[model samples]
Target chain A: MLDRMKQMQAALDRLPHLRRMGALFSETVLIKVDGQEFYLVFEKGRIAQLLEGPSKKTPYRFSFVTDEDAFEEFWTATPKPGFHDIFAMVKIGRAEIMGDILLLVKNLRFLKEVLALPRARREVVE
Target chain B: MTIEQITGRYLTVEVAGRAQRIYFEEAGQGRPVLCLHTAGSDTRQWRHILNDPAITAENRIIAFDMPWHGKSLPPEGFMQEEYLLSTKAYMETVLAVIGGLELNRPVLAGVSMGGRIALQLAVHHPESFAGFLAIEASDFQPAWYDIDWFHRPDAHGGEMGAALVSTNISPYAPDTERANTLWMFMQSGPGVFRGDLSFYTQDDSLVGQLHRIDTAKTPVHFIVGAYDFTCTPEDARRTAEQVEGATLSVMDEVGHFPMSEYPEAFRPFFVDGLARMPSAGAGAS
Candidate 1:
C-alpha cells in the first residue's frame, strides 16, 4: 500500500499544470488507516517522504483518517457513491478530517489529485 | 465552419425593484423547456443538451444565468454588501424571465438548487408551468456547506471551489471531461458559489413543504444520478416520498454534474424525463 503511495510523487511530476499549481506547497499529511498512522511529507508539490508512525513528536498540517475497508474501497478504480471521494466518505461517517481546513482547501487541487493516485488509471480531468 | 443553432440575448427585468439584465440562450423551435442551472454555475451547464438535435428537434431549450451569476452582473451597489440568494428572489427571477420571454407554460427543468426550486415553482405557481423536471434535486440537505472553507481570504475560491465540487463528479469520467466541469467552478466569482449554497442548504429547504407540490396540476419528475454524493439517490428518494404523485428515476454510473461530466450517459435519462413532461410534443422526434 505504501508503495502505491510512493508512486504519487512521480505521477504528479508528469502533470506540469498541477505541479506548477502546488510548486510552493510543502507540508506533512497524516493518514490514519484504521488504528495505524502514516505521515506523508510533501515538498514542492511532490511527496518527498513517507513515514509510518506510532510516534508523537512529528506534527501534521492535516489528517485524513479512515478505517481499512473504506480506504481499500476509496482507492478502487471506480468507487461507489459514498466510497468515491474523501468528502463522500466524510458524508457517510466512514472517515474523519482534522486540522487546518484552510491549508487543505488551499492545496486541495494538488492534494486531492495526489491522494487519488492509487487508482488503476488516471485521466487528469483537466 | 459549423454554425450551431444557439444564440444569446439579454433582457432587462425588474426584480425586487432592482433592474436585472438577464442573459439567456435559445435553440430549436417547439414547446418550451426552460433550463435552470445548478448553484454556482451559469447557463453553460446546459451546453450539450441545448445543442443536441435529439432534444432541440422536439423542444425549444432556453437557459438563463441568474442575477450575480455568469454574465448577469450584480445590480448596483458596486461592492458594498454580501450576496445571498433567497427562495423568493430565485422564484421571482424565474417568473420574470418567463414573463419577459412570453413563454406559455413551459416545462421547468432545474438541477441542484435549481432542482429544489422546482418544488417551490410547483407549489407557488402550479398554473404557470406545464411540468417540472428536477435533476439531482432533493427537499433539503443539512450541513452540506461550509462558507469559510472556500470564501476566506487565505483560500483561493476558484481552486477550492473546483477541487471541492470535484468530489461530486463520477470517477468513470475521463480526465478531460471532468476537467471541463472543474473549469466552471474555477471561473466562479468570490463567494458566489457559497452564496448560492445559502439557498440550497438553507433558505429554500422544502422539508415539510414538498408534499405541497401539486403534481396533479403539473407533473413533478426527478431524474438523479447514482454518483451524486451531495444529493444522493437516497436523498431524491426521500424527497419523492414526501411529494404525492411525484416520480423519480435514478440513473446508474452518473454523478452530480451529469451533463458536463458525461453527457452521453445523461442524454437517455434526460430524453426519458422530457417525454414524461406535459409539454412533450407529439412523442419522441
Candidate 2:
C-alpha cells in the first residue's frame, strides 16, 4: 500500500503544473490506513516533506483500509463498481472520511481517476 | 447491507417506467466515483481502472451497466425515442440508480458515449456531480453536419448524423472474438442502434453551456486519445480550453479506448489528476 502511495505520489510529481495549481498546494496530506497514519507534504508537485508523528494540525486528511480480497474482486470483475457505491459507504457511516468536505468534493473526480490507475493495486503475498 | 454487499450485488432500479439492473464492484470508502460506459459496451470497460491499485488505495469506485447492455435489460419501448431522448432517459436512469443506492455528489468518469453523457450531466445537472473525467469526448464539431456521407441513406448515413449505433458488433471486435461479442449487441437489437444514432445526431453545441459551468465548484479533467477517430483529440482539447480550470491530457499512441488499450498509462494520468483536486473543506468560493 505504501509503495502504491509512493507510486501515485511520484505520478503526481511528474505533472508540474498540477502541483502548482493544486488546492492545497503547499499543505501536507495526512493519510491513515488501518490504525497507522502519516503526513506527506508536497510542494510544487514534489514531496517537500514527510512527518511520521501523530499531529492533528494538518490542513488536509483522508483515510481508508485496503482489503486484499475485496480489492481482487474489484479488479477481476467485468462490470466493476461506480462512484455511487464507493461514496455510499461514507454517506451511510459504513466508511469514514476525515478532514475538509468541500476540498474532497473539489478533487472528487481527480481522486476517482487516480484510483482507476492500475498501479494502485495492493501487494499480494504468496 | 454491508458496503461490500451493496456493491457486490447486481442491483436494479426503475427508470422511465423500466427496471434496469446494473452490476458493480467497489473498493475503498469515500466520495462515490460513478463510472459510465461507452457506446456498444457496458460497465465492463472500466474493469481495469476500477480495480487499479491507485484507485482502491484512496477512494471507493463503482462501474455500472448502461440500459440494454451487459446484465441489464432494455426498457420497454426503448426504441421509440430519438437518440437524444434515449440518452436523456439513460442519464435519468443512472441518476435514479445513484439516488436509489443513496450516494451524494459522486464524481463521474465516463468514456466515449459515457464521456458525452458526463458532459451533458455536468451542464444540465451541475450539482449532482463533484467533477467529471471525460475520455475521447467531443462537443460536436460544426463541420459534423457538412459531411455529405451522413445524410445518405443506410447504416453509414446513420453513423454520421447519429453516433455509430450498430447492432453489428462484429465490426468492433477482434475477428476471433466476434461471435461472442456480437451476442450482446444482437440481443440489444435494432432499437439500440436507432437510439444511439439519434444520440450522435442531437445538437451538441455544448460550448455555450460549458461557459456556464461553475468550474470553481466543479472541476473537470479531460483525457483524449491522440488517435481517437470518433471524438478527435482536438475537440477534447478545445472543450478543456473552454472550461475554466479544466485540465487536458493527451495520451500519445492511443486511440479512443485508453482504459482498455493502455491501462498502465491511463491509470497514472487519471490518478495524478485526482491527487491534484482540492481536498475537502477547501471550501467553495
Candidate 3:
C-alpha cells in the first residue's frame, strides 16, 4: 500500500495540469485508513510528501478516516456500492471527513485526479 | 434493484424532415414518467431512479438523451462546430421523441436546463404533458462566468469548466457521486456546456410567462437543492408562487444534480415530489 502511495506521487508529478490545479490548494491532508495514517503534503502545485504517520505539530487542513476495505475499494477501477466514494462512505457511517470545506471544493478535480492515479494505472494494466 | 436490472433501447425519430436516433432507458411497469437530463449530461443521471424497484414497480420510467448528447448524435452538418440549444429547437426534438415513442402523456421531469424546458413545455403546450417535476430551474439570470473560459485550449476539454460545475454539487454528497458528476462534465463535447448556458443564463425567460401555465390540465411541482447556488431554493419558491397549483420543496444537503448525486439520498424528495403531483391516469389522453 505504501508502494502504491508512492506510485500515486509519481503519477501526480507527471500530470501536466497538477501545478495549476494545486496552486489553489496547498495543505497537508491526513488520510487515516483504519488507524494507519498517511500525510500528503502539497506545496506549489506538487505533492511534497507521502509520508507514513501523522505530522506531529502541523494541523491537517483536510482529513478522512475509513476502513481498509473502503480504502481499497476507492482505489479500484470499479468499486462496489459502499466503497465507491468518500461522500457515500460518510453517508453509510463507513467513513468520516474533517477539514476546511472551501479548500476541498476549490480543488476537488485536482485532488480527485491525484487520488484516481492508482486506479487509472490498474485499469491500464488489465 | 441494481443498475443491471434496467434495459435500454434506441428510437430513430424524424424532426423537421431530419432523421435522428435518440437513446432512452426504461424500467418497471405502470404510469409513464419521462425524465429529461440537465445540459451536457445524458440519461445516466436517472440510473438510480430506473433501478429502484419501488418506483419501477408502479411507474414505467423513461429517460432519453437529446441530440448531440450521449448516444444521440445530431443530424449531419448541424451542430458540427458549436451546439446552441434554443427553445424552438429543443421543443421540436422533444415533441418528435414523444411522437416517435408514442408515450402516453408521460409525466415530464427534468433538472437544470431540462427543468427550465419542462416549465416552458407546460406553459406553451399544456395538453402535451400530464404533470411536470422541475428540479433546480426557474426564470433567468445574467451569465456569472465567462463562457470563453470553458472553451480555452488550456481548459482540457472542459475539465477546468467542470471545476466550477463541481461546486454546484453539494460538498455533503458522497465522494463517488461527486466524482461521477465531474466525469460527466469532462465527457461533454466542446462548446456544449457553453451552449447550454446560453439557454440557462441568456435565453429561456419565464418571468411574466409563468401565468400562462394551466395547473388544472398540467400541475407543476418544483424540487431545488438547498446547497445549489446557481438555482437557489428561493428561485424555485418565486416561480412556484407565480404559477397556480405549483408546489415548492427544498431538499436538504443536495446541490444541482440531485438525481445523479446520491440517488438513494435523493429518492425520498423525488417520491415526495411525485406525491405532490396529481395522478396521470392510464395513458396520454
Q: Model 3 segments beyond 4 Å from truth? A: A1-44, A47-108, A111-126, B1-3, B280-284
TM-score-better candidate, 1 vs 3: 1
Tens-place lDDT digits, model 2, residues B1-285: 622222455777887776777666666666577777766556555666666655766667887776656666665665664333355676797788778777677778887777777887878887777788877777764332223333223333322222222111111223223333333333443345445545655646465777776777778889886545556567798877777888888876455566654565567777866665544334422
Q: Clashing residue pairs in candidate 3, if any? A: A85-B176, A87-B174, A87-B175, A88-B174, B104-B284
True contacts kept of each: 0.97, 0.00, 0.12
lDDT of each: 0.84, 0.57, 0.77
Q: Give the best candidate by TM-score.
A: 1
Complex DockQ, candidate 2: 0.01
**Docking outcome class, model 2:** incorrect
Query: In what order do the candidates fall by DockQ, top score first?
Result: 1, 3, 2
What's model 2's lDDT at B55? Answer: 73
User: What tens-digit string does per-residue lDDT give for candidate 1 at B1-285?
Assistant: 998888999999999899999999999888899999888889988888998987898899999999888899888994997888899999999999999998888899999888888778887887778889989998887656576576877667877888888888988876677888888888888888888887777773567887777777788889888889879899999988888998999888888988888888889998888888876442222
Model 3, B1-285: lDDT tens per residue? 623778889999887787888999999887778899987778888888998889888888999998877888776886446677888778788888888878778888989888988988998887878889999988775565556556645445467557766646764577778788777877877777777877788884666998999887788889998766678787788888889888888887688899998686689989987776656583357
Best by lDDT: 1
Would candidate 3 be rated incorrect, acceptable, medium or high by CAPRI criteria?
Answer: incorrect
- Tell me the DockQ of each model, to 2 decimals: 0.81, 0.01, 0.09
lDDT head-to-head 1 vs 2, winner: 1
Clashing pairs in 1: A123-B175, A124-B175, A125-B175, A125-B179
Provide the lDDT at B54 for model 1. Answer: 73
